[model samples]
Target: MGRVAGKKVFITGGAQGLGACFGHMLADEGAKVALTDINGEGAKKTAAAINEKHPGAAIAIAHDVTKKDQWESALGEAAEAMGGISVLINNAGIGTAGSIETESYENWRLTHEIDVDSIFIGTQLAMPYLKDNQPGSIINISSVAGLIADGMMLSYNSAKAAVWMMSKSIALHCARSGYDIRCNSVHPVFTRTPIVDPLIALGGGGEEGEKKLVRQIPLKRLGEPEDVGYCILYLASDESRFVTASEFKIDGGITAQ
Candidate 1:
């Protein structure tokens, strides 16, 4: 029942989707969690729900990951609330698809700001606390778009690919510095999350739409949130102590073909 017992985790973008799912899963497995989001009230509500099941195991913090001041303050508050930070999940991001020919520079910049730069800032600010809590884990959520290419997903593809490479660099740095902080990136395919609602809408919004989305996936289905959550659980726990600087693909064998 206690997979991450005594671990303190700080997760960004925990208002909903995978972030909230991860919070619930980790807390259920005995980790105290700090859930942060730009939607402050949403984060609080998620925290309250988790606390309902496991009282005092969850806290909510208002945070804007792109801002240095907010990152510093949020990490400090999370550390104080949870006693220390053993896991950091850089999960806040957006997926706006646009080709370079059609995408505005502003949109590209915003994409990189949230999807790529936030990881750099969050990891840097949280490194000290992670170092303090030896055997820490840093989980960065990338996307299959990062590993592959889509003409329409120009900015998202670029940003998430940056995250993929950055994670490896961070993992190597920690290893070189003798910090037992394992950093890894997770690449998920078209999961049944709100993030895919737009793509679903493009296909006319129904089972048929989902079928179209899964056509390329060898499994012929969308990924469940639990699919990625279980992987994160392993990385967050001591079971994956030797795993670092690697990419975990939650895609349905899309990369294989």
Candidate 2:
């Protein structure tokens, strides 16, 4: 049997990249998948592709993670489409890399809204459904930058660190309240996503940046979307039943040394 058989999963920013990869992976494990993204067209395309491979397995919703109303609507749509959400993956986030002095207030606010506030909104919105289900899982996608500071990612790193702490807080709250839900965060470094492409361009196409980055990592390669997806699935599934209030680092040893 598939690991996530009969589970219902709701993912934000699921139109492409790591979120899309998670949707595909969970659906493959027999979970009913609902993908939500700000780019409605991209969400549709991703859902269609997944459905083609696993017919009738997924649905797509247009959602902006920063808005509470949109999150409510997305959750309602997901419940209607997939029955009930057993897994909530708050994978929607954005990054801005620049010296602290060079970053605008607007950029900082936007980064926090998407990267940190999204987690708060998603978790708060999902609580009712998750509590009703009991024994559900919530996974927040953080970043290695959350654990270790980078040269010019001040806002991004700050937001991610908040996300990491938020995950711990939620987990402790759930445990203390005797709710059967678990919360965790994943910290990954320089994954191959469009989010990092612009940053790489700032240093010349990621080649030089990647080489410099690899020197700090034993794995010596950028992480794939699937790598994060699998880690998310593990936490979402029963395999990680005892794991909560913890940060799982998928940084290829970047944080190890």
Which structure among the candidates has the greatest lDDT? Answer: 1
Deviating ranges (above 4 Å) for candidate 1: none
Per-model C-alpha lDDT, please? 0.95, 0.89
Local distance difference test, candidate 1: 0.95
lDDT of 2 by residue, 151-206 (tens): 79889889999999999999999999998899999998888888878756765664
My TM-score estimates for the predictions, one after another, are 0.98, 0.96
Best by TM-score: 1
Q: What are the root-mean-square deviations of the candidates from the true structure over C-alphas? A: 0.8, 1.2
- What TM-score would candidate 1 get against the native? 0.98
